[model samples]
Target: MGSNYLLSPYSLKGLQLKNRIVMAPMCQYSVMEKDGKPNDWHHVHYVSRAVGGTGLIIMEMTDVEPDGRITDYDLGLWSDEHIPAFARIIDGVHRYGAKIGIQIAHAGRKAEDAPEPVAPSAIPFPGPEYKLPRALTTDEVREMVRKFADAARRAVQAGVDTIELHGAHGYLIHQFHSPLTNRREDAYGQDLARFGVEVIEAVKAQLPPDMPLFFRISAVEYADGGYGIDHAIQLCKAYQAAGVDAFHVSSGGEGPAGERKPGNYPGYQVPFARSIRQALNVPVVAVGMLEDPALAESVVGNGDAELVAIARGLLRDPYWATHAAYALRSEEKHVPQQYERAYH
Candidate 1:
């Protein structure tokens, strides 16, 4: 028997996870009907990870509105009718002893398929293929907050163990917080985290008191003169006050990298996660190229972060958690009964 922190159990408020291994929410873009609902593809895609022994599975960026999606194929919780589809996936994940969460977001200017995308400012996403976005009116901004709360309400009905507000990766919440994107002169402009805080508070009202809420944040922007760790820490403090239980620390999705380029090596973002985890005194999930089993194990074992989110690694191998347990010589064998022969 060998000790492996990555395979150890973790608890956050009402959510109890079997291990520290998190299946990062990666968009599948497989919504065949373009109706903002999960189908067979999403069901299998997420459940297989649970069956493979992931501790937690955060579903991809599910939007609050139809036009909030990056593309029509993305998932959304705009209507009650969409609840059943997500419920099916969540139930399946639970059956395999994995907890599930949904990342609710709005694409804003990143809504590639919207006829007219909306943003905090009328800025394009620095790509020729992207369309210029119109700024949201003050009333529209308030309404957007309500939309986020509504989505959270529906997610609870669909039976998620927790909820994650996608405030990273140049999405709507990211745009509102980033100086590079939010040129608004309104209150949202003066207080960069105002939009995110509002959304957090609103979403909190819809969640169970014991259920923890996670905020996925870009620890630092890569654009020239963009906000760095100090700014991210301040944002996290405000979000923490507003009810964010933890943060998933990632970086450099606000725009293309500037003079300070993003790291392409493994565990490059772990330092940022560690910084935030220390500064805020909250648990964080370290992501970005942390696929190597040894590296993933180190992040948790070293106390850099409470969890390690695997993106492409889990994609390449559904049994990543099980395989990692074996590789690390963990005493707990995570393989399923049917797959016991293969593991042995």
Candidate 2:
């Protein structure tokens, strides 16, 4: 009998994953024509990983509006016309026996291509490439929440098994919550979590009742005087109340690191995932440099995270899940029949 926890099946809400392995959403930035639609490159890039053995594949940050994209090359789901393009890739992934989700997000002030970017405050991201963003008005903020819900509705029409909201990495949602970014006299500023809560409620209305909602969060900020694990815990509590079923715990990317530089080692972010899982009593996915098969297995085996996400590693190898299965001696590797001889 195989004892590889990484190869074990996991079920959350109505989403059932064949293994505890998730292909973390990494942007392709390859959307040609800048029309917010998936092209052939995206189709092959994602479907190959599904075929390789990833249990749950999260598509890259798909913006709710064209201007919300980090760059013209990024994907978007602002219109119903974009649904069929995504459905093609999703159908291909399903054929390989993998469940797929989309990470809906907005680049906010980080939008390099926006003629005039927007944020909670007028603060510009720490880079010359980024423009000083216009602060979103109270009415615009509410409209932004609606955009998230609209994009989610399009994702459902595309036949996604689940949806993930990008609340980390200094995006729109993160900007509103982080005290560093949001500084206003309005209700959203007074209540740091109000924007995120509203967005969550709005998106939830578009999702199926049993489809679990995943939230990607930065457990700690690396910038000087930034929020830490405790603050993140409180945020998670509010998010849990608002209806987040699971957390994909990651850290940093709020801005440049100060004295608190991010760790550059394996499992550097696992403890944060463990912290949230224990604090919120909810399943969490551990990410960041956790690609080694043994290290990945240890994360799940130790109960630190319910799942492990591979980012650059999967970019380096499409068949990472299968390779890990072999390394761990998992009996249910699920290698394709054509590749059985390679494993034997």
Candidate 3:
């Protein structure tokens, strides 16, 4: 990659990367153990992306607790035992010269199989399968912060490159972020950002000072009563003060499907990433449908975001980064030695 912005090296605190193409965290939901342990599928799926020349491989949402999972099949790091299984993938990705991170999350009301799901309030996700969640007690809210911290601790022990807090897509953290869902009268209710701030502080305490922290946010809600991009910006300001090194900017998961829908086009969410990056003066990762190499490159070249996340595109072609280098007409050859014959 001959100095194209997308192929350019980047760093955040102590985490350095050879390029800026980040594999956005996408849930595989393939854990066969029911015990929240990653199996071979997760291993091969992530390693392929690394060997294909991805700079960063952020694993899918791995809940901090069992009930925090979107499904029973998702990964979890609530126990010390879960560390080794994750270490396997982290080691593999590092071996291929790619840094790895895991998104720690809590599904909250979105928990599908929880006998009783929990959220900022008692609202239920809109569906027959979704049940109204019990509002977490104030004390319980404090405990959840500790849970997030513990998950971060295990992530560090597992030797991952970074940590991205799953604060988007209408999960537990999202429930707290949006006023549409958080209606309590307590301290958490006093500030839409209290929960997120606490979680950030708690997680940071567990991490080394130089380890970069990435946070994902749904910039706006599609629901008629949802929060706007501005609200998310303010929330991010608080998180930035609490030591978030970067943000993964995305939009909408709090509303019912198609209610406050965003435009279906490449780089539609780039504006959100740009806004947060400028306003907070921190690096942001732009995501959402940015599959085109030219568009992804422009996003970086034009200085919209520090990095671009490719989710579904990487799924279709694990070698998207290498191909992107070719398409961008860069001398950046990310091909592995084994694939050199084919590339040449």
TM-score of each: 0.99, 0.99, 0.98
Q: What is the C-alpha RMSD, rounded to one decimal, of candidate 3?
A: 1.1
Error of 1 at 340 (Å): 1.0
Superposed by TM-score, candidate 3 places the C-alpha of residue 14 at a distance from the truth, in angstroms, of 0.4
TM-score, candidate number 3: 0.98
Which has the better TM-score: candidate 2, or candidate 3? 2
State the weakest 10-residue window (summed lDDT) of model 2.
1-10
Q: Write the per-residue lDDT of candidate 3 for residues 214-284, one digit (tens) a residue.
A: 99999988888788888999999999999899999999887675556787999899999999989988999
Name the TM-score of candidate 1.
0.99
The 0-to-1 C-alpha lDDT of every candidate, in the order given, reads 0.94, 0.94, 0.93
By descending lDDT, how would the candidates be arranged?
2, 1, 3
Give the clash count for each candidate.
Answer: 0, 0, 3
Show the colliding residue pairs in model 3.
Answer: 1-331, 1-332, 222-260
Tens digits of per-residue lDDT for model 1, 1-344: 76679999999999999899998889999999999999998988999999999999999999999999999999999999999999999999999989999999999999999999999999999888789999999999999999999999999999999999999999999999999999999999999999999999999999999999999999999889999999999999999999999999998777788898989899999999999999989999999998888899999999999999999999999999998988888987678888888865
Candidate 2, residues 281-335, lDDT tens digits: the string is 9999999999999999999999999999999999999999999898899987989
Give me the overall lDDT of model 1. 0.94
Against the true structure, candidate 2 has what lDDT?
0.94
